[model samples]
Target: MNAPPRIAAPTHAPEAPRLRPDRAEAGALTRLALPIIMARIGLTLMLVADNMIVGHFGAGPLAAFALGLMLVQTSQMLGLGLLMGSAVEMAAAFGRDALDEVGRIWRRALAYALAIGFAGAALSQAAPTIFLALGQEAALAASAGEIAALFGWSLPPVLVYVASIGLLEATGRPYVGVALLIAANLVNLGLGLLLGHGGLGLPALGAFGVTLATLIARITLAGGALAYILLLMPGRQALGRPRWSDHRWADGRRQRRIGYAEGLSLGIESGAFASMTLFAGWAGALQLAAYTISINLNMLMFMVAVGIGGAAAVRVSQARGRGDPAAMARSAATALLLYTGVMLVVGIAFLALPGVFAGFYTGEADLLAVTTPVVAGIGFLSLIDGAQRVVANILRGYGDTWLPTASHLFAYVAVMVPAGYLLALGLALGAGGLILAIALASVLATGLLLARLVQLKNRRS
Candidate 1:
């Protein structure tokens, strides 16, 4: 990967625009964040639909689906993160008005996606063994393994298209993905209802049915995104054209350098969450129930941060390419301010109406009692956690990768996991202990990334 060029600031600081709050800047930030946020929400809904469909079958099937999907998603996260580097690269390239270079990045990303996707497929086939090793019930493991193997095979299309989605986003047509993912969700729901419950004289496929439905939906979205790029987007043919003289082989390593760090960062961060989920099991059934519901909501809200962060990424990449230090500063500041302000509102709502959110998930008084504090506390967690996600993306936009990745590993795997065990198990705080660990990790990560952003700003001048 190339070293990012520093933003050369004028000797006179007063000549540049001040980085402060303004209505026009805030409006621009909202517009940029909204579509990306919509895309994230759509993707979240797709998973929610799968979970909902499987849930109708019974607790056992739901457990299998949950375990199986997590296994698949673990690998997906790695591959997806690796491919994500292309988006940042392409966005910067676009900022420089080098359309052909953007195309080359996308082509290489698709190739990487295929290679990684196949490996994921192989892992899916062995997920049952993993489940057994993790001490899951034999029957549950078997069911989950079957579903994972089949759905896992779809990774090639799923990931290849994800790279495509990134390219489209970098090219400034971000809404296309939003439309396709939402449509895909609808397709998944219809097929899930049919395949899982059985219809038209077909037998019920149970968990496998939902997996199959998800696969088909993925294919449709992937196909749709590709078609839009090739047929409708401007300068489509310039994309994917190889330079015969240049060694395409060597660039793959550069792409890996670019993306692998982000992927590893995500894996470690997610691993911390996974470890807590496991810890919850040790806490007991009631605590586990509370942990799962509250955590899921946390994740959902985190997506909002992701959306805001994604917008920052696009803006920052473009700023880098155009060599606009002031623009870069404004983009980052506006995104941070916007995200924090919105999250504070969400946090306040959670504080005031924690029971209201929990009631939507379950009616059991015990479950509600356990969930309320977690929900209330989540408002603050969301503020930091969401900020951490954005800060990571912002750094990625500046072509800074591994440092942030290391920060996540240190904060999450190093800090959060051990803290959860000590606090939850050692202190007997149960689910509350795990939540506190998450909050600590998020706060640490957010602080470090923000400091890095500041350094980058100072360097620009």
Candidate 2:
């Protein structure tokens, strides 16, 4: 019955008519983006430490760990997408200062995350057998099985960590979530180093030990974050004695419709990457190793872009809540620019010294040789990928999840996978062909998503 309160405009008056929209948007984006970029760099450093420790152990463990990470990341993308999509919804609700709705959204998301986590755990437990049945190489299948076993145990705690992160990001306290990640990763880095090798009186558990370290990190983060949210945040009372209620199937239905759409879209997108990995696997173990190296290096760049995209979602959602279409458009454009600039620099560096980046993963000459071109290709792709992700997030922030989901499905599943399979297998282009297909799909997806965002902005205008 009540209209939402207006967000007060900035108090500081400009002497001149306010700066151009591009300038203002850029300023706002920089303010939000810098912290996110720093956080991502820190997280990347932690992963680098983990990989450095693992790489020292031996190639087999490193390869196994890489495969495990790929499997977990692919499976978890659905849950991650669901959390993020719901977070955008909640961010919009929060920007309207709709506290009651925020609570309901959080509860619903936690329920969804839990269910998804359990299912992911179950699937991960069965992954080795599934891959084997898919006619993978015997050695690779056995290693994949071992990795899956580690992932099965790691799933529940990681899910809790991810769910907590969703709630934190939704409430517009991403800094807190970033802090938790920093602390957890620090612990993981130290423990991984000590236990991964036979250092500091700790018995080396090899890849499994590193997996255990990651599990510990996730549990620690989940526990710490829950405490911060419930006890320490400024508006703790909102969460403390707030209304809790029985499950509303209608709300669940609404969320699932949105969440599942986003989830499946992300799954298809990530599944394409996984399929590429399979294709690369067929080329040779060295090629698979190269694929793993190049991908890990690229993730550093991707993570930064994702953090900005997350902020874009939050900013756009908040703007949408206020019925400020212009501000939403400005925010989206600003985020795209910021992410593009950052990715461009990273991409250039990757292209210039692909081998240098791959060297971080292995000392093997053969693996490095195979990975160089893949890394170079991904560097160019990252620019386009970064732009598309921002555009997609902006749409999502405006509560338009389905369109982007459809776009991703069309681009990744329909185009990327089929193209890559034909090039890699039918035409025998090998790893290079797979990477080329990826580059093409990313460009297409980016262009389509950007066009859609422009059309939506025009309609709103």
Error of 1 at 140 (Å): 4.4
lDDT of 2 by residue, 1-461 (tens): 99999999999853322112377777777777666666556555655666666765555566656666667768777677666646656765776887667667766676776777778777787777876776667787777667766766555666666666666666768788778878988899878766677677778887777777877776787788778867787775664343446257776566566667777877888887888877766666666666666666666777767778767876787788789887887788778777777778887898898877777777876666766777887778777766677778778877787887788888888888889888877897777777778778878888898788777777776
Model 1 lDDT, residue 131, Cα = 71
TM-score of each candidate structure, all chains considered together: 0.85, 0.87
Candidate 1 lDDT, tens digit per residue, 1-461? 99999998878656444355556766877888898788877877767767656655544565566667767777787887888778777876887888888888887887788899999899889888977787666776687788888989878888987898889888888888998888898999999889988999988898788889889998898888888887888888767566652337776566667787878887777667777866765565567556666676777788899888887887777788889878887888888888889999999999999988766556667767887888888888889888999988888777687878889988999899999989888999988899999999989999999899888877786
lDDT for each candidate structure: 0.80, 0.72
Pairs with backbone N, CA or C atoms under 3 Å apart (clashes), candidate 1: none
Candidate 2 whole-model C-alpha lDDT, 0 to 1? 0.72
Which has the greatest lDDT? 1
